[model samples]
Target: MTKVRNVGGKITETTKGNDNSFAKENITYNSQKKISFTSDKGIKHGKPETLPPPELPSKCKVEFRPSKSWQGEFGFDWCRIGDSQLPVDKPYSDIVGKYGAIYATSPSAVFTIKPELYQRHLAEYEKFVLSAFGTYYVPNLSLMKGEIAVLDAAIEIKENPDSMYYKYDKTVFEVKILEKLSNTKGKHFNDKVLEIKCLKEFSSKQKIELIATKNKIDNKIGQINVLPNNKVKEIDILFIPVEHNGSSGTIKGKEITILTNALKQAYVKGNIVRHKEKIKVGGWWYDLFFTKKDDKGVVSMETSNIRSIHRALDDVFFKEKDNEIYKNHYRVYMLTNSTSLNGMAEDIGKNAKVVVVYNNRNDSTAPHELMHAMGLYHTFDNDGLFTYKFQNTDNIMDYTHQVGKDRFSTNTWQWKILN
Candidate 1:
């Protein structure tokens, strides 16, 4: 039988009937009697005694030590690599030893750490600390679910692809910290302070600015200001489906596909295509979500009676919670089987826009509601009583009951407002 020896608090073992080296490097074993090597000196085992924890350094260090022990509950809230943080769900051990020697441990996994491992960990850990103290975190990595950006640490040295690389992923972010904004129980966590701007649904003006910046980058312009031209661009549409009884307005059967095709057809039928072959592919790319229902599986439509239904869904489903992170996407609701008015598009709060339409509409409904979302008002003037002008039937914003072919003609002011 092999006897176990205690070298300080570290446990070591030797092979039976063999006086030689241990299975682990740097450890020595003996046969007739158990012996362990400490710093190339053989030492015999005695009664195990617990030693006091090692003292922590005033500042972090990089060199490894052999004689000293380490103390304190050193752990990291997150681990940053390149511009992204590894999705470590649990608190990770970040033990610091004498002379600031560091070692990181995880509850679920182990890493074959090199001598320089702690150096990288320390660098990333410093970024996390800065973010915890409220630093700007601009990440180049795509974010995960329930995660939000915290801060980024600037690196003086430029990274080379071959030497500095993550083994698992293609690219590693320099440093980024992120935290779950809400827990599984749907409770908000204020301590996880992170800011990310790209996920926001930008306005048309903001989108123009983004396009201008991209143009500046592409053209390699040293000193220039970019301005967007007056051309219709593709818009992102997040289609939140609110069905009363598995049907929207009056349209039933395959909500997403049918509605998508109908919307496409409406735009195509309106003769908005740029050319024959250069058809707009992402003219209205969408992400769909079903309406929230009660325990009885019935969707309540009464705004007065079922306010919670609206409130809960509105609170949860938004651009901020978007997993795909679409830029400048508009959140519109396709509320089905409504017994009320046809459709409405208005602002809910500051910088918040919502467009809702019932299902009983034709192909033109989606475009009409979309025009409202894009800042277009009805053709009929509504000073007190709605008065229809001669141009009302000639425009897409005209009332549905009007008697003429509707075109997508907008005045100069209207176009300026839309863009």
Candidate 2:
């Protein structure tokens, strides 16, 4: 490989090979005269017994450099030659034309190299140098440890002032190579069903029974049955109060009331019944089966709420808005601790979605959380918009109850879930 060094001392690698077995020769003329050529083997066996000669003008000079590739199977070898500086009016073609014969050519059709052709060859050389060393002109190309190579080259120049003499020179090149790697992986998930159990104290108070009264528990259970494959199976909620009014008890009377009332509100007013039928719910410590055989298949989800209960709600309630197949078959969950939004749905559990709010809060929190549960991301997350700052305070996702913020913008990332 060819190694090039840049002005900044950076080295670049090229695809060219390192073999350099070449030579150069020069020819000069004092007066107008034709020139001849000869093969490296010094054998002149062609169609014509005598070869034609080239007409060289007065005071003209020429230089020649030949290069060959060791790996070349065909005629990939090439040569570069330069002529002495002459007036524009000089007829230089006549001189090189004769030299073509010596190099093996016919008299009637002598080959002559043009000035433009020479310029093109020079350009190619410059490009090769830049590619190998990283820069064409610089302070000096830097040579790395494994890049040095000895080259066998020659430069031939001919002048016209007096008897012309040819000059030859040799040079070496050092190169280096660099490599880089990148990583790009998307999102993924493994299980589907989310197991949940009610806090022990809440369950002991017959919270499920008390909540059932708000909207006829039997009727809601029937509605849950309507769900395909009885996707949502409710395991008896068991609540264990880790902390109760700074006292320890199997079941506290006041705690039961609070638990029952919370359940009632969550089921009746909060519309938990509709979701129960569509999602599978298990006791807090129950074994969750999230395999393909389960009614709720593989689920894709994201979450900020790490609480087990909230995660369970997400699996049971969330669905994607537009994803028809997975939305209909699987369950997604977005566990959130925010009390601003209670829960949201997209066609219920028919699509992959989220359940934003987890902490018990005011009624308004349900809608907001549900909005997120319905597969709606934050409104402020405008990914590629140059004008929008990702963490800006004005964004709706950043809005807090203290600010009395409760509005969804039409031009927000949240809209993507709907479409």
Q: lDDT: which candidate is best?
A: 1
Quality of model 2 by C-alpha lDDT: 0.25
Best by TM-score: 1
**TM-score: model 1 vs. ground truth:** 0.29
TM-score of 2: 0.20
- Model 1, runs deviating above 4 Å: 1-234, 248-300, 303-313, 316-327, 348-352, 382-391, 400-407
After superposing candidate 2 on the true structure, give the runs of residues whose Cα lies further than 4 Å from its correct spot. 1-283, 286-351, 362-376, 379-396, 412-417
- Per-residue lDDT for 1-419 in model 2, tens only? 34554475544555566532222332243435655556477955454332212122222211111111111110111221112121111122221121222322123433444455334333322121212112221011111112221111221122213232211111221111111101112211212111112211111111110001112211110000000111112212222112111221122223223322222212211212112222334343123321112245522122233335444554444453432323322232322222233333433223433333323343333334443444444422222121121222222232333345322221212222322
Give one digit per residue, the lDDT tens place, for model 1 in 90-172.
11123211121221111332223233533433333212112112221111121221222333222221111111111111121
lDDT of each: 0.32, 0.25
C-alpha TM-score for every candidate: 0.29, 0.20
